[model samples]
Target: MQPISRRTVLAGASALVAGPALARADRWARVVAAARRYDQLHAILVAHRGRTVVAEAFRGDGLDAPANVKSVSKSIVALLLGAAIDRGVVPSVEARLAEVAPRLIPTDAEPQVYELTLQDLVTLRAGLERTSGSNYGAWIASDNWVADALSRPFVAEPGGRMLYSTGSFHVLGAALAEASGRDLLTLTRDWLGDPLGIQVPPWTRDPQGYYMGGNQMALSPRAMLRIGNLMRRGGRWQDARILPRAWVEACLTPVTTSPYSGLGYGYGWFVTQTSAGRLGLARGYGGQIIAVAPDAEAVVAITSDPTQPARSGGYFGDLLSLIAEEVLAAT
Candidate 1:
């Protein structure tokens, strides 16, 4: 091999810096230091303009180790749903859920159940009794997760309100698989993983062999950042259109205002207005997050232990917001 030229070395170094001059130094350092101090976070990945600016693994997890991304998996499922639609596997979001999975619906199902649509599930307005709040532990322990999720009684009129439910996304996953004649993991690998060069490991499946859709999906921090970056680029990876532009816009658009946090939630992402601008995020239980800010052309992924309450919203969200405010602000 020929000796490397000074110009080639400088070009390589320049590519490593994510964005403009400000992002190359103090801004990147501040984010790394803050995450270490506050959240005891396992890994942090920051990308700017489609390049890795800060990619560091910590807390005993290697860069390739898959981290359980909890509810952030919902966002991944959302991508699959969009891809399914684009491929003509599913007709449209307006399609009724009962029509898609008639076998799953009880013969004497509640009237509200009939009213639930694919759109309602994606937006978390399906009106099903939620599995996220008080019923979380029980839902996890149940052997027949899909049956248990579909068995929930209607608590409100479909499309009348928003209720956070992992079960809703689970149902969507099931419907997609049923319609496509492929398993959730297989569909995801074909639609997303293969195209993006991200490996989503063999996901945990229910007894029925359906991959769990809304939670506990495993991906490396780098993989998580790639997903965020895809969204940041309007669902296109490099030159290929992995998801439709319309679907991406719809997924990121706010559907309901959150009752607990005042943030806006869309299909599977949370929309928050911070000092840096509008930030779209996939927030998982226990402080795992993949935040994408289009205005800044930035994506940040973080993973932390969920059992630690202080680390959850207190440090994780704050640290990311601070990075946007203090670091990205200068840029």
Candidate 2:
């Protein structure tokens, strides 16, 4: 037998790394084929074990182009809340909303407002009458979004029912700013974007200068995948624990059940059961999704324009399930 040469040794090491790469490429080809078959997908990205298993941007968009994540912004806000809690700058979620935003409370406040807690907002059990559906556009366009949100009549007792409210999330953003004595965008940038190497654009701000917390945030598909991967890894990135493990667990637990889809909502994430198993995801309008399947050790992020009348189903959900069934199963 011929003795092994240095070149042969280097070739063997390269193949070891290339082995996974080639396998991933094959898996991605299937995902791309599925996306093409579906017809509305603009982008799809998949990651496993913190590695990019597949990334493809269809429909002429590049990876760097920012796509509006709509409600995925809510999950990012939840992370900010966790970071604030971990730093001891804010007290527990039990803290009264009146204590955090005294201005929003009427001087002769209703008893329900006094009883409301930060936890209520996070859990979507705030009991305020929600303007979350058709009225959202007008509500967001109002001159005083926070005040307008607060003006909504109370439908039930505080913490009594699960009412999906974008207004509630906006209030949470305001509360965080009040408790930490910093603007929401600055705090988010310093605590999250800078640390994670994410480039969050200057998001639309309310008339009061608070970042629009409930919706209309932009992120690259890769950034969305990164956030999902972080959640999959239990709030740690590589060696650093960026968020509290306990808090992350709490974020994944179901706090309220969704009337629209029957899935459960926790903090900002959505908990649902798939054919494969239980999973957590952040879904946004127009088919943007950040799906984390912990059992499969996979995260898939997709951005697409599903609002088009021709393509008006849950394409993101369908595409993700297919990827889980086909590509992930192969691995």
Candidate 3:
């Protein structure tokens, strides 16, 4: 065999290191080009193997500007519940609503409402009439949000099919507040924002002064990316164990299925089987998404116009296709 020159050896080693980096750059460039097609999108951030590889802002808000995350707040709230459990603020998922926040229950609430558990509320299986969609205005307009949610007639048995009610989560926030002797914002800041090193700006509050649970929270795209990365890392950040690994794993396990998109509903995430991996998505109104693909060790955060709808048949579907085809494929 011929002896190789020192210059030749150095060139070969450099190529070996640069090859994957160049490929990643090429793939993300394609992703950015495809993302521009959607006028609603504000930003897209992707992190691979625990480091940010791509961050782009196309319009509207800048990548670091806080934008309304809408129902993605529900996912964050769910994490708070897990943290509460870990801290012994609340007992466990099996704890009954009436047991924890008995005063919040309305006088006329159905008998089954008292039996509703933490798991039921987090999973949207509380069986209460939905306070989302067309009924949202009236529910929010009510004199007392927590009472209104509990007083709603039972549309199904507790722990039945998913009802997709924001009211359930609102009631949950109230209960957590009552149980912990701390408000939702305080809990969020202490448990999540401080740990993840992200800002948690105050959002909408109900008539009784409880922070809205399932909607209207604000976080920058970068903040959302940190959250996704925390989840991707099994609820840890650096040296700190921000969330229990078991709790994070539980959040990934399917507890129910969403009726709207046919995706499995975990603690606060929507579960889906994709070619790249088992995707756990924290979705919101408009096109906001924080997707964690554990199999690929990839986390993607997307923010869009909060005022517009991103239904399954429209813009949201396009976002999913973009993640699966370009983002995950690159991983």
Error in Å for residue 23 of model 1: 7.3
Output the better candidate (1/2) by lDDT.
Answer: 1
RMSD of 2: 3.9
Which residue ranges in model 2 land beyond 4 Å of their true spot?
1-25, 106-109, 306-313
Compared with the true structure, what per-residue lDDT tens digits does model 2 show for residues 1-331?
A: 9999999999999999999978877877777777666666778888877788778887636566788877777778888888988898677778888876777665554577777888888877888878688878899888887777777778877776688888888888887888888888888788877767788887888988988877888888888887888888888877787888888778888877877667788877888776666678787776778888877788888887746422123665575566667656745
**Which ten contiguous residues of candidate 2 have the minimum total lDDT?**
308-317
Alpha-carbon shift of residue 205 in model 3 (angstroms): 0.4
Error of 3 at 223 (Å): 0.8
Can you give the lDDT of residue 310 in candidate 2? Answer: 22
User: Could you give candidate 1's per-residue lDDT for residues 1-331 as a string of tens digits?
Assistant: 9999999999988877655565456678876776677545778888888888777776747667788888898988988889988888888889888788777666666777776798898888888889887898899789877778767888877886788899889888988989888999899899999999989788778777788889889888888888988999999999998999888877788988767666788877888776767788787877788888888888888877755542334665575565677546634
Give stretches of model 3 more than 4 Å off. Answer: 1-5
What are the TM-scores, per candidate, against the unseen true structure?
Answer: 0.89, 0.87, 0.97
Tell me how far the alpha carbon of residue 291 in candidate 1 is from the true structure, in angstroms, after superposition.
0.6
Pick the winner on TM-score between candidates 1 and 2. Answer: 1
lDDT tens digits, residue span 25-77, model 3 = 99989989999889999899999999888899998779998999999999999
